[model samples]
Target: MNVFEVRGGKKLQGEIVPQGAKNEALQIISAVLLTPEEVTINNIPDILDVNLLIELLSEMNVKVNRTSRSTCIFKADDVNIDYLHSPEFKKKSGRLRGSVMLAGAMLARYKKAFIPKPGGDKIGRRRLDTHVIGFQKLGTQLDYNQEDGFFHLTAEELKGTYMLLDEPSVTGTANIVMAATMATGTTTIYNAACEPYLQQLCKMLNRMGAKISGIGSNLLVIEGVDYLGGTTHAMLPDMIEVGSFIGLAAMTKGDITIKNAGINDLGIIPEKFRQLGIAMDFKGDDIHIPSQDSYTIQKYLDGGVLTIYDHPWPGFTPDLLSIVLVTAIQAHGSVLIHQKMFESRLFFVDKLIEMGAQIILCDPHRAVVIGLEREHQLRGITMSSPDIRAGVALLIAALSAEGKSTIQNIEQIDRGYQNIDTRLQALGADIKRVAI
Candidate 1:
């Protein structure tokens, strides 16, 4: 195991660039399987989860060429379908949640797919109902193997149909959309996730010869094409990291500038941090978060306590709620964080409480954070990272605490963020990686 030894109370400065969107990369990289020709992808984040997915693809005989650390050329001309049933495939794919996406691309082109129970962050119940039902609606036959613990999917022929998703799940929508792209007729998906990453997937598919309309809306209509071809794609900057930097700047009283932040694609992330009274300046594609001694939470017009909740696209993202919650620790006022999407994300706040932050975990999905107002500095202690987002949140708290903090299970953090400790060190953060 590896741990991060973060010496807190040192202000970070200098400019940092956010890596390619991890969410977008997962969907985009999986989409490469839809075509046989060379599909070049640029700005791929060099992170664990994405690399695991790429390695899974390579193991399936997808020809992969690394043009650079951020660029790759993939040709899936001769993917070995039998590999999907191999024990090696199950072991590798089971460890990666993104592996489920291969089912959509495989089922669409190969008429068959198999996936074991996928693994990811243990945040809450992330069900595959939407993907399974959507595949069934498209005339696919699904069977479950109890002993092997794999979902077996096969389709003699896929026929496009209408589907109203139970919830607007991003991955579920991407999987269904990929499957629908090659169906025989038109497919319409309502209540689809319209996050920028999903939109990027739709646009990338269109570039690859799939006719998809409603680029930035909940309703998506796809005119099924006989086959998709190869196309080059560039990933958007990771908005989650941009938001994390905003929170980091405020908490550590640091002057940090994030380059190529994809501001327009960030949706409501910047405004949410602004609601926390964190001042920022937008310079073209960059976001500059100025150092601040303290920030105040904004209240409603009628004088109600401010409430920040996660919603679908165009609303505050659930991923950043943890960052927002931690950023408010030294703020001037209080706020309520409602994590409606995930049931167990708020459980990480206990670590912050142990570090001397004032937080009340209302329930599984809600918490109230009363700002410390900088009168008290958080004291560092040993903690373990629970999930990717919460892990980064804990790291942020550790950076702002008064003493040295040891963070274990940092592998969870590396799964999402690319070279986080090294990146933070560039901005003058006192963080180092050490093996246990």
Candidate 2:
């Protein structure tokens, strides 16, 4: 196992170009299976999850070549769809949660897919009913062998139809968009996730000759095409990483500049962080995060407690809620952090509380954070990372504490962050990665 040993109280100072979005990388890499031509994708994040997805593609006989640190050339010339059910492949697919998306790509290409149960954070019961239900709406017959934990989706010809999703599932929307792009009729997706990553998917699909309307809204009307040709599309910068850096700079009192942040694609992030008194100044495509020892939580005009809640897209993302909660602990005022998406996310607050953070776990999904404001420093503590966002949250908390901190289970962090220790070290962070 690997652990991150962080020497606390180091201010991050430098410019960082965020890596490619991991969420998008997984979905896009899976999309390669839809066509049997050489498709080049740029700005690929070399994260653990992406690497795992690439291995999944390789097992399916897709030729993947790493052309650069952030580029790859993929050709799914001959897809062995049945290989996805092999025990070895199944284990790799189970390594990360994003493996479920392969079902869509395989079904689109070979008309049949068998995907094992995905493995990821036990944040809560992350259900696949949303994925299955969406595909079933497109004329897919779903069968599962629970003994082997495999889901079989078989569709002769997918017919597009109207779908009101059970919820705004990010990956579910991606799967449906991929499946519907090659379907026979016009597919109108309501309550789809229009995050920057999803927008990238839509843009790439459009470049491949799929007529898609409603680019940045809840409803996506995708007109199916007979076939999609290969095209080049650049992935967007990692907004989650950008937000994490912004939160780190604010909490650690450091000045940092993020280059080519694609500030326009950021949906409600600046205003959302501004609610916590964290503001940024943009110069064209760059974002400058100024140093601040502390800032007051912008109280409601009614003089009541401020609440920061996470919702679907066009609102705050639940993934960033943990980072915001950690940031609020370093600010000067109190605020309520509500994570509505996952039930077990707030349970990690016990680790922060043990390190002297003033947080009250109001419930399974909510926390009330009282800021320390540098008057009281969080003492060094040993903790284990639970998930990707929570792991990064603990890393931020560890970096701002008074003494040394040891954080294990960094594989969770590796799932989302591509060489995060190296990235932070480049920004003057006192963090080291070592095998334990």
Candidate 3:
């Protein structure tokens, strides 16, 4: 196991570049299986989840070449379809949630796909119904074995039709879109997820000769194509990490500039941080957060407490709510953190409370935070990470606390953020990664 020992009370200053998008990397890497030509991808984050998915692809005999630390070329001219049925395949695929996306590309090319139940953060009940129903809409037969926890899907020839998803699930949308690209007719998807992750997938497929419209909208139309070719695609900067750094600068009173943050796609993240009284200067594509001694939480004009909640895309992302909650600990006023998407995410507030913050866990999905106003600094303590986003949030909290803190199970952190300790150390953070 690995742990992070952080000596707190140091102000981090300097420029930090956010890693490439982890969420988008999963979808884009899976798309490479749709074609047999060389698909070159740049700006790939060297993280555990993506590396594991790439290993799975290699195990299936897909030609993968590492051109650089952050660039890879993939040619799936010959695939080991028999490997997908082995026990080893199920064991490896169950390690990461993104493994579920392989079914889309596999089914599109081979007319069959099988996978064990995917594994990922245990934040909530992440249902696979969206993916199953979307595939069934395109004339695919689905079967599940409850005892072994495996999914079997087969299709002779997919005929595209209209599909209205129950929710705009991001991975669900990507899976369905990839499957529909080679169908026999036009496929229309309503209530599709339009996040940049899906948008990038659609654009990449379009470059590879897939007919897709409605790139950044809730409705997508894909025309069936006989074949797809090779293409090059680059990933966007991770918005979640950008939000995490913005919260970190506010908590530690640091002057930090995030370079090449993909400013236009950030949507309401910068404004949402401003709602918590964290000011940011946008200089071109970079976000500059100036050092401030203190900041005040905002309230409604009717004298109501401020509430930060998550919604679908084009709204505040749910991934950064934990960071925002921790950032509000030293603000001037109280704020409500509503995690509408996941139930178990807010349960980690008890760890923060142990570190001398005033927090009330109203329910499974809501918390009321009363700022200490810098009157008393938080005293760090030993804690375990619960999920990827919450793990980074606790690290931010540890950076601003008064004493040393130890965080275990940092593999959860490693699964998303690339070289986190090294990157933060470059900005003057007192953190060290040690083996336990």
Candidate 4:
């Protein structure tokens, strides 16, 4: 296990670049299985979960070539279909939630996909029904074993039709789109996730000879092609990490320039931070945040308390709600944080309360943070990270606190953010990684 010892109250100043998008890497890597030729992907984040997926691919006989720290070429010319049912695959596939995406590509290419129950942060119940239902809609028969915790899917020449998903699940959309790309007919997916990651996936598939229309919209029409070819694709900068840096600069009172932050794809994130009265200046693809001694929260025009919530795309993302909640702690006013997509993410607010921040856990999915406004500095303490987002939120809190703070279970942080402590240290943050 690893722990982060942070000495707070130090103002960070420097330039940092956001890593490649982790979510996009998952979908893109799995798409390699759709084609037998070589697929070169650039800007892949060297994070724990992604590495695990790459290792899983290698274990399945996909030839992987590492060209650089952030670039890789994958050739799936001889994928071992028999390995899918092996104990090794079962063990490796269950290590990350993104592994479920392999089922879609595997089913598209091999007509059979076996997946163990995927594992990830236990913030809430993440259902696989969306994935299963989407696969069934594409002419795949699904079977599940409760005792063994495995999903077995088989199909004979997938024939696509119209599918209106129950929800616009990010992974579900990617999986169904991948499966539909090689199907026999045109597939129309309504209410698909139009996130930049998904859009990038669509672009990559198109370059690989898949006919996909409506790139950045909810309704996607995928005309199944007989085969897909290899293509080189570059991933966009991680928007979640960019959002995290914005919150870190505000809460710790620092000046940071996030280089190549994919600013155009970041919808409403900076505007949401501005609602917390943080000053952000944009120059091309870089975001500059100036040090602020104090910031004030905005109230509604009707004189009501401010509320920040997550919706689908073009709105706030639920992944950054914890960061928003933590950054609001030092603001001059109050705001309600509502995480509508998942439950139990707000439970980490108790640790903030322990650190002398005024917060009310209204429910499993909502919290009201009363900003201290620098009237008093937060006193740091020891805590355990609950999940990836909350762990980063706690790290931000520690960076802005008064004394020493120790955060355990930092592996969760490593799963998403690549070399986070090292990146923060380059910006003058007093964070040290210690093995325990």
**In model 4, which regions exceed 4 Å deviation?**
none
- The CA lDDT of each predicted structure is 0.94, 0.87, 0.93, 0.93
Each candidate structure's TM-score, on Cα atoms with residue i matched to residue i, is: 0.99, 0.97, 0.99, 0.99
Give one digit per residue, the lDDT tens place, for model 1 in 380-428: 9999999999999999999999999999999899999999999999999
How would you encode candidate 3's per-residue C-alpha lDDT over 361-427 as one tens digit per residue? 9999999999999999999899999899999999999999999999998999999999999999999
**Looking at model 3, which ten-residue stretch has the lowest summed lDDT?**
143-152
lDDT of 2: 0.87
RMSD of 1: 0.7
Clashes of each: 0, 0, 0, 0
Q: Which ten residues in a row have the lowest lDDT in candidate 2?
A: 102-111
Number of the predicted model whose lDDT against the real structure is largest? 1
lDDT of 3: 0.93
Segments in model 1 whose C-alpha atoms lie over 4 Å from true places: none
lDDT (Cα, tens digit) per residue for candidate 4, span 141-231:
8888777667889998899899998989999999999999999989999999999999999999999999999989999999999999999
